[model samples]
Target: MKILCISDQIDPLIYSNTIKDRFSDMDLVLSAGDLPLDYLEFIVTTLNKPLLFVFGNHNLKELPFYRHSFEDRFRFYSPQEERDALTSGAIHVGSKIHREGNLIVMGLGGSLRYNNGPNQFTNRQMNFEILKLVPRLLFNKLVYGRFLDILLTHAPPLGIHDKEDPCHRGFKAFLWFMRLFKPRFLIHGHIHLYDLQDVRTTKYHETQVINAYSHYIIDTGAAS
Candidate 1:
């Protein structure tokens, strides 16, 4: 399958009216985070494909819709009223596991705790979030012979594609997760690439770690 991965910035190639023709063959769309909800909704609606995304540290105006309880949500707007309010047809896969066809994807969104900002977590806090998914991962291992096909996040893994700065630093918990679960791919976005010489893809253990800064195309069959 051909999967189009996007994050951070909005690419003109994707935001144009010719998007349907330019990426007509894309089977799925995955957003690593830090993107506008309307952009995702546009892609899903135009392509008529499944779009799965997670939250980043920015462009999160509609985050409360996913974080609040059903009762709390009703206070703002009724379920029917809010249905088309934000990212209308897209799915937020943060801290959750979703299966699309034969692919199993797990999302762990957010950046390392740099401040008291939304979508930021400490190393311990991120680990606890991972712990919440252990049962489902183990179940996938038993049933599918693999823990997961993809680990989607907003930040890269520590010491891999991460920088030394606190805000851009990757999570150590992600390294531990990759070592144990061994997903086929770990796709993240947060670090922006300016120079063409900067690396965007890296091989760590059995997983292919990719930084979806502006956009990228993953042809699963080519790698397989």
Candidate 2:
């Protein structure tokens, strides 16, 4: 299956087909937050594709309606499954081993800290959550032996993907998780630079880290 990833910007096509016109080739969409609700609605309506996303620090009041809209296609991860977690979030898709097929994926939506919202978790508080969830809830799947196909988190992993700005905080625990799990891919959003550059890729610890924004596509089925 093909996966199209995006984040840190508003979906430009809801008003019409402006953004969608450029990215008609994507089979599935994964958003990393900082987008408009109408843009999401457009994905369900005009684009008519499956989407998964996490919120950025700036996005507000979008969670309730988002879950209500794409009840089946949207997935967000929790502190229970990962130390890095987000509020106003839900887990909508596959797991580590699960991505082997359509590719199992899990996501933590929202930013490093909540400027405002309901389900936000602090960095330290998030670590406490990971301490509670790991060894118990994590690594219990088919991908446990080697590596998970994909591990999605709203927070970027530490210095690996971080930029040099105050608002550009990266998730340390996420980096730790990347080193430990060694998933085939690490997907995330939040950094504005990455959102603007339109593409960022790194080969770290045997995994491919990608920042998906406005328009991105990959045919994973044929890659392996």
Candidate 3:
């Protein structure tokens, strides 16, 4: 299937009405992280396709909704409204497994813990989080004959497409994950690419690691 993977920055073409014209052949939308909710909502609404996303090192904030008032026309919603909007239509695949047809997606969100930011985890914390998914992965191995097809995350694996800074540093546990689970592809976004000459795809064991910054398109049908 043709997949449209987006993350980090929002493109002007997508915001404007040119997305449909440019990405008309996209079959699925996978959001790695650090994107606005409204942008994701707009893309999902426009494409009318399944959108699966994970949280970056940021939390969802409330949006301004207008009301029919003169002095205070802006309406502030309660906590429930904020919660509902955060999870309205898009699927949060963090720390879980989701299957779309033949595609088995394993999601683990967040980046290395640096400051007291949301969705940031330490090395130990990340390892603990990944341990929780082992049972389910083993189940998939016994049932479907494979552990996973995709490993999606907000940060890249250690020493692979990661920066030197603590915040941009990849999870050390992710190295073990790739060595063990051996997913067909491990797609992540945290390091932003500014130059066209920078490489985005790398091979780790039998898995292909892709940096889904800004936007990327791939065909899972052609993947082995």
Candidate 4:
């Protein structure tokens, strides 16, 4: 399946109405967060793509951008919600098991410890959340059905591209998952210009870690 993953910045060049045909062929689009609701609206309404996303720390405001009208583009998620609820007016953490063609995917969205809004997590707190999934949902093959095929998060796992800055912070727990589950792919964003290039597919234990940005595409599977 062709997956168009984007995050961290809003560019008129990409989402603008002028760029219509450039993005129309995508099967789905995943945004890691920090984009405006208008951007989401354009993707679903204008670009004609199925849109899925998590909110960033800055997405909580009642921006004038949305004061004029409302569309079903924006969805809210933290750590607790799950499932695909497009018509339910609910949002998820960009987490949960998803199937795309032959791929099974899971996602973790939000930032590390920050004194801000909407989505944020501290290192230890994030670790605790990770622990909740291990043994309980992720590591237990008997329960989670099959091992995950792909892992996606807004922040990259610690050390690869994470930095303790205002906009980027990796989760230590994600690193723990690397050694534990070792899924096929791990994709993330949030460290904008630090390393804006798409990372060459690298392995964490057995999983391939990729940095999917606004201008990039993460195409996986034997066909890729």
Q: What lDDT score goes with residue 18 in model 4?
A: 69
Backbone clash pairs for candidate 1 read none
Per residue, candidate 4 scores C-alpha lDDT tens digits across 1-224 of 57777777776667676657677666667777667656666667776666556655566443212222234246554333322223322224354555555555666667876774445778776676566555435443675465676676787887776666755767778887878777877777776664536353567888877766554566664442
Per-residue lDDT of 221 in model 3: 83
Instruction: Enumerate residue pairs that collide in model 3.
Output: none
The TM-scores, one per candidate, come to 0.93, 0.68, 0.88, 0.71
Candidate 2 per-residue C-alpha lDDT over 45-142 given as tens digits, one digit per residue, 9 for 90 to 100:
65666666655555545454333334424656453533322222333431112243345555555555635344355677556645654553355444
List candidate 1 stretches off by more than 4 Å: 69-81, 84-87, 222-224
TM-score for predicted model 1 compared with the true structure = 0.93
Full-model lDDT for every candidate: 0.90, 0.57, 0.83, 0.63
- lDDT tens string, model 1, 1-224? 89999999999999999999899899889999999888898899899999999999998767777766345645666665466555368888999999988889999998999987877899999999999999999999999999999999999999988899899999999998998999999999999999999999999999999999999999777321
- The true-versus-predicted C-alpha distance at residue 177 of model 2, in Å, is 0.7
Q: Rank the candidates by lDDT, best first.
A: 1, 3, 4, 2
Name the runs in model 4 displaced over 4 angstroms. 62-95, 132-145, 164-167, 194-202, 222-224
Task: Judge candidate 4 against the unseen true structure and give its global Cα lDDT, from 0 to 1.
Answer: 0.63
- Which candidate would rank higher by lDDT, 1 or 4? 1
Output the number of the TM-score-best candidate: 1
Candidates 2 and 4, the one with greater lDDT: 4
